[model samples]
Target: MTLDLIYSTALLLALSALYEFNIRAWGQRLFAAQVCAGLIFGAICIFGMLHPANLAPGVIFDARSVILGVAGIFGGPVVAVIAGLMAGAYRLWLGGAGALVGAAVVTTSVLFGLGMRVALRRGWAQPRLLDFLMFGAMLHIAALGWFLLLPMQHLQKLLETLAFPYLFVLTPSTALLALLLNDLQEQRHAKQALARSEAMRRAITRASPDLLFVLDEDGRYLEVVSPEEHLLYRPLTETLGKRMDETLPPAEARRFQDFLLQTLKAGTPQKIEYELDTLGGRHVFEGRSQALDIRVDGKRAVVFVARDITERVKAEQDRRVAAVAFESRQAMLVSDAGTVILRVNQAFVDLMGYSREEMIGRKTSTLRSGRHDAAFYEAMWESVRKTGKWEGEIWDQRKGGDLVPLWTTITAVRDAHGAVTHYVATMNDISERKLQEEEIRSIAFYDPLTALPNRRLLLERLQRALTLARRNGQHGALLFVDVDNFKQINDEHGHHAGDLLLQEIGSRLGRVVRESDTVARIGGDEFVLVLEHLNEDPALARTEARQIAAKALLTMARPYDLEGLVYHASGSIGIAMFNQAEVDLDLLMRQADEAMYQAKHAGKNTVHMHGG
Candidate 1:
């Protein structure tokens, strides 16, 4: 083969390979269309080679424009430009005048491809028929410009034979085809979006905690979504499509129907409270209805959405009833201004042993025991007004002129603006508890045998005396005394004789000490004396301690005549003085105990100072 023929064959093969590569790179769907177009064009070129005709010399058809436009509209502009370059190179290798025509085809194809890509990216192309027409017009204009650059004689023949038909007939037909394809794709996407939205709505309705139902204007149930269907004692599927009266009791159905009708008539929304007698007993519901303009059988109709608020409604009713009963039956009272009683229940009158005529319009102070002063009332009211409630024990006076104790709670009622409206007081009688408390106090602090101060009481009085002496720059004394040989009387003459001797000693000490002093029996044979208001002289404390110790020892030495028995006792005394040197009660007590040990160690029946 000659060099020219070899170049033409190589060029044809190269174009075919380039087209295949573009197709594969873009995807099989796009590549298939371009390959099909190329096959058809190649067959036409072979047919022209076999049967050549001598006719008017002009460009008969421009397959380049057709292929490029198709690629641009379908696979986009980049593919078209690639195809155009391959076509131009193949025609040039053929070494004919058609090469120039091929160059024009290449230029027009690139412009059409790039322009369409820009328009599409910018959203300038409409999605419908207008987009098709605009795109076709742009391609034809590019083709016309390419044809103008051709030789004059050939261009004139092309306009007459090829340009008119391609612009007016072929371009519009191609646009119509593209439009149909777009419409199909849009329909598919719309169907998918609608399906997703419907599935989401169904999921939400099924999982809701409340009983949700849709009703028509005539009160027929269209749908019901409820998790607690067993509580209603009816399958939700069975209840659907039935009238409200058919599925519900007559009374409940009537109330629901009325609410729906009212909502439809008003063209707005309404709420109605009603009760349902289901298998779970009485369940309350607050039915809320809103008018919905829904399409049924291609005609407009109203639908209502009713939600069950059974738990909330029942709780509200129970609270209201309990509040009213509590205010009416219990010993409830309300104060209007600054503890002034404005209202009192009959239970309060009976509890305080007072008539209603005597209690109303009276200040709370009328019941006060005078044990707590005005500051006590102020503190109680402060807590009530701040926190709205206070509860504890309180003391008051009864109508019969006796003090009564009660466990009382006071609460402040406030208005919407947060201003105090009234004070509510509730109380229960606790007089018996107060009496028991007093008896326990006496037992804890006093000695039952001697009717005098016990250890606990003595410690308290001694601490007080020390504090007074420190404040006044005076002195006090604590004397710890023990009977020296009282155990012998119990061992020799029996325990009865020892008890008689101790009683006699206690009597003698009480007679010797002043009324202000405290004489305490800490044990069977031990006693403590707390003497206050002493002179600053240390000798005075010692002198008083010695005098008490002498009186106790002398009283014990005399024989106790108990049921014809004789008993004698002596006492060793330890004295501790409280002055400016002593800082606390514990240290003073320790000093007194040490002194008593020293007295016992020195000898029997003697007194010892803490320093001595």
Candidate 2:
């Protein structure tokens, strides 16, 4: 009996070796592997049963309890159920008085193994040698009670003889088998964890844009990891196991050596900005080096990471130049895409009469003069959208409520995608230029003394009026007036007083006419008035002209104050009514002059009409 049980124990140990090698390969397909494990456990039970320590005809004791319990804890409930069913079915096939009790023992062992599985999973028990021993002891204690269902003769004999060996030998075998499976489970988990960690490290190294290097304290390259081969000064085949002095220029090699020494001494990360002549081109790099915990080839090691920053360095330089140019003498304003002011230079502050604090964070509309309509501004911005620039004259208000004309150029600053990111405007104050232009125009077209339209301007206006009347079928009048006895007054009161009288007469004549009429001082002591938009009919037109002429005579008849001395002045007026039908401009002027002489002959200070 003892020899037969020894054979059963040896078989189980051999099966455990097979499990360690083949079972883990089946682990990926969990249900399939569990079913397979159940079959294997069932086979092992059958082998144990075939060679059991038989005390009766159909009753047997074997390592089925150990195998099923380990299956429940490791292969889970699936293996436990299949193994228990198979072993119980076979035991019942060999019918005897102990058959039912043997099947019951199988069921009780599976249930107890499942319970231990739950305890292990919830951390209530561990898969250790001692814990498995306790588990086997408890499972077999319950299994021993199931034998009570057997025949009284078999039960008494089995307890007296087999109980001690079953409890001592089989229970320890169960623990030893469980401990073997536990070691297999822990090894599988360790391998999986290591695989995942290695995969993650490889992924990070490949995905990184930086060039990674491992160097010794003597500046010898131990390893290099670069995703892009062109980023390296030389290929990895040539770079590895080489000193920096052998592969790089003296200055650059010295720089790397110094950096490596510093990283080792500091025991922390150190940073440096450097330039490298790579296969691609000369590039600026930002390098960070940290001392490693281990040594390489009998020397302290460091890991260096270099990131290319060529574009970033160039952009910073460009920004510095732009900042310097922004503070130039010309007034400049910068705003965001939303037209909210961001920055204004000192020149802009002086020109706008507003401090920098008041303008920042405010919209550009805050400086609007309201001189331009909405449509005008819309068109201006439209040009900037299409062409990226708008340049012209704009009227903007200053802080003191004065409007200034500025020749402004607005340029849109765009990003790489051609989206407007900011607006840069340069302005020049044109106020002085505007004043000078006005003075030039006044000199060309106006009288100096009376500040009225000169003869040149009068003739230009007269020509325009004739063309207008020709189109509208209306009559216009030209009145020519000459002061009475002006030569005598000039001889007596001097040219100054005579000049004063002419100025006053010009003023009075202007008061008597409508704003649309032209009151021009064509010569000394002579003036011409061009009246437009009179009556359409020739007869009514004549009457309108005579009425206006009589009013002008009365205005000239009023007393004039020359140099604070009251001087009475009078003038004779000649009226010539003409329509567009009159072709010759000189003819109209001659007729007005002839009528003026007629008034002078009839009596001074009187009015006469041509062909009346």
Instruction: Report, for every candidate in turn, its global Cα lDDT versus the true structure.
Output: 0.67, 0.88
Count of backbone clashes, every candidate in sequence: 0, 0
Which regions of candidate 2 fall more than 4 Å away from where they truly are?
A: 1-7, 13-55, 90-98, 156-162, 227-230, 235-242, 296-299, 414-421, 448-450, 453-509, 519-546, 557-612
Candidate RMSDs in Å, in order, are: 15.4, 4.1
Which candidate tops TM-score? 2
Write candidate 2's Cα lDDT for 391-502 as tens digits: 9999999999999999999999999999999999999999999899888877888888888898889999988888888989999999999999999888988999988888
TM for candidate 1 is 0.48
Candidate 2: RMSD over Cα atoms? 4.1
TM-score of each: 0.48, 0.83
Model 1: lowest-lDDT 10 consecutive positions: 47-56
Cα lDDT of model 1 overall?
Answer: 0.67
TM-score of 2: 0.83
Candidate closest to the true structure, highest lDDT = 2
Clashing pairs in 1: none
